[model samples]
Target chain A: DVKVTQSSRYLVKRTGEKVFLECVQDMDHENMFWYRQDPGLGLRLIYFSYDVKMKEKGDIPEGYSVSREKKERFSLILESASTNQTSMYLCASSPNRGGGNTDTQYFGPGTRLTVL
Target chain B: GQQVMQIPQYQHVQEGEDFTTYCNSSTTLSNIQWYKQRPGGHPVFLIQLVKSGEVKKQKRLTFQFGEAKKNSSLHITATQTTDVGTYFCAYGQNFVFGPGTRLSVLP
Candidate 1:
């Protein structure tokens, strides 16, 4: 079974504070993604990394950055946390099939971030 | 970027009742995937349909892909309390997910 673990399950931060959400996958998948889920908004992609040091912006990447220094780890950085940034953060990883076919994503336990 | 739309933003059903959710796309899709997210839990992959007009079933749940590959539906027969959660339909390689249909099954 694939295991994806996040650094924190729940986090609280103050406005303008720097926040980091970490995700690690044991499957060594080549594709990793960061998403923020809000009510009625579904899961919106924030950033994704296809390989080490390779990053791509998703639909909503503002105020957020990603780091993929290693294959197993992906980090989401909140430049300066704001109340509007509070949402459930999810990390997913999928193996590279090297084709146009879509791969199934395995998700980690989400981190619910609260910005006050 | 592709858009996937799901109907019945919310549904409440009593135990043993049937429930269904629909997902539609403006343009044809190569494949579609379904996911379930329990309350306070992250979304989990349920199933994927690649072939058009394909139907797959798991236990009492049925998933169907439209012949046009532009729509899909998930149906759950005899709902159980454990089935309460949000159902999402995703499309495209980027996995653009729908807003999701929240299901509440009352025992």
Candidate 2:
């Protein structure tokens, strides 16, 4: 079975603090993504990495960045946490497809971030 | 950019009743996918529809894609306790899901 593991299931941080959320998928998928989910707004993409060192901005990417230094791990970074950023963060990975958005994405258990 | 919208943000039904959720998109879709996420759990893939006007079934669940490829639906024959979850429909070149329909089943 494919497993996508998150570094933390819950986190709390103070305003202006830098935060990191880590995700690892053991299935060797090449495409990974970060999204934030909130009540009413649903899930919005923040960043995605298709390969090591390659990244792309999604619909809502402000104040956030991602790292894909290795094939199995992806990280989401909040440059300066704020109360408005508190939400459930999800990490997803899919097999690489040269074709756009045509692959099946597997998701990890989400991290609920609470920024004070 | 693609836009996928789901209807009836929330639904409440009695066990053994039928339930359905609809999804519409602004543009034609190469494929449409469905997912279910239980409360406090990650979203899991339910099925994918590739052809226009396609319909597929999984036991008590039925999935349909519109003829124009811009809409889709998921119908449950008889709602059960296990069917309580948020159902999402994603339309795109790939498999990005949209806002989901949250279902609550009552005994």
- The clash numbers for all candidates, in the given order, read 0, 2
In the range B1-107, model 1's lDDT, one tens digit per residue, is 46788999999999999999999999999999999999988889999999999999999999999999999999999999999999999887778899999999989
- Residue A107 in candidate 2, Cα distance off native in Å: 0.8
The fraction of reference interface contacts (C-alpha pairs within 8 A across chains A and B) present in each candidate is 0.90, 0.61
Best by TM-score: 1
Give the per-residue lDDT of model 1 (tens digit) for A1-116: 99999999999999999999999999989999999999989999999988999999999999999999999999999989999999999999998888778889999999999999
Query: Candidate 2 chain A — worst ten consecutive residues by lDDT sum?
Result: A96-105
Question: lDDT tens digits, residues A1-116, model 2?
Answer: 88999999999999999999999999999989898988877778888888999999988899998999999999999999999999999998888867565677789999999999
lDDT values, one for every candidate? 0.95, 0.90
TM-score of 1: 0.98
Error at B48, model 1, angstroms: 0.6
Residue B86 displacement (Å), model 2: 0.4
Task: Estimate the TM-score of every prediction.
Answer: 0.98, 0.97
Instruction: Give the residue spans of candidate 1 off by over 4 A.
Output: none
